[model samples]
Target: MSKAIDHLMKVHRPKQKIQNNRLRSVIVSIYLTKFVPCGDPANANGGRWLLTFGSPDMKLDDLWQETLLGMIGDCFSHDSDPQPLSRFITGCVVSIRVRGHKMGLWLSEAQNPNIVREIGRRWKSMMNLPSTIRIQFETHNESGSAQQKPIYEE
Candidate 1:
């Protein structure tokens, strides 16, 4: 199963590191935190966050990984003239729980209105999100509060 997933994501399979399920979760959490962006200007504005809410039986964790891999592949399909915006992708995450599932895409800059909007548009296209859904971008400062509001909505 792990090998199949690795192939689908176009990533080298990681060797099992822990026997205990709880300990494995802790180790994975630590590994994931290493990708958090630094406070440099390129990343200071935070990044675009796009989430996909899927039904409980959608197995969205797998779906998110597959979608990300597919997007990455599409970005580089031009060989020598790949899209510039692809470079802005910083990280992505998927969360699946008893209630539902969500996937997030994190980019490097959210300050440029044009770039942000383009990224959002391309993302919706590449991910093939349903036409009924509207994408939005929320800056870090604008998202931390209890009554957080998005900076822009499409």
Candidate 2:
């Protein structure tokens, strides 16, 4: 994934008869001190909330914007908790796949299921995704070819 790439929202994909067939992934990495792959200390224990849109739509832009704004604008917080959930978030990504586009929100801790689940719940709301739409929470570590179960979902 590209680190700290700008204008990711503006990056257009090649026209396709079926929009879901798009191949290239658009990644937007948000970091605290440095890039993740470059050994950013902040992401040592990071994980991400992954949302896959089976069918891309006009709302995709709006959903992404809301997430980015929530992170940079410090608008995320759990009930009765003054700590901003964004503090744990490291970055996000939008990866295009043959069947759909995957949007991921990276967070700094994977061990805390409460925080992780809370973030997922907030993101589902932030994106206005209905109960029909389910998202996954997974660690940043690659599990190789083995399929790892989602740690949590919301």
Question: Which candidate tops lDDT?
Answer: 2
Clash pairs, candidate 2, are none
Q: How far does residue 24 in candidate 2 sit from its true spot (Å)?
A: 4.4
Q: Give the alpha carbon lDDT tens digit for every residue of 31-147 in model 2.
A: 444564425666767777888777756366677767776776666775577677778877777665556677788888888887888888988887788899899887767522378
State the displacement of the C-alpha of residue 147, model 2, in Å, after optimal TM-score superposition: 2.1
Lowest lDDT block of 10, candidate 2 = 9-18
Tens digit per residue, CA lDDT, model 1, 1-154 = 5554465555421112222233222111111224544454555676656564645444344445545564545451333533566666666655443344445566667777766777677666666667786666777555556877777666
Show where candidate 2 strays beyond 4 Å.
1-25, 37-39, 143-145
Query: RMSD, each candidate, Å?
Result: 6.2, 5.2
What local distance difference test score does each model get? 0.54, 0.68
For model 2 the TM-score comes to: 0.75
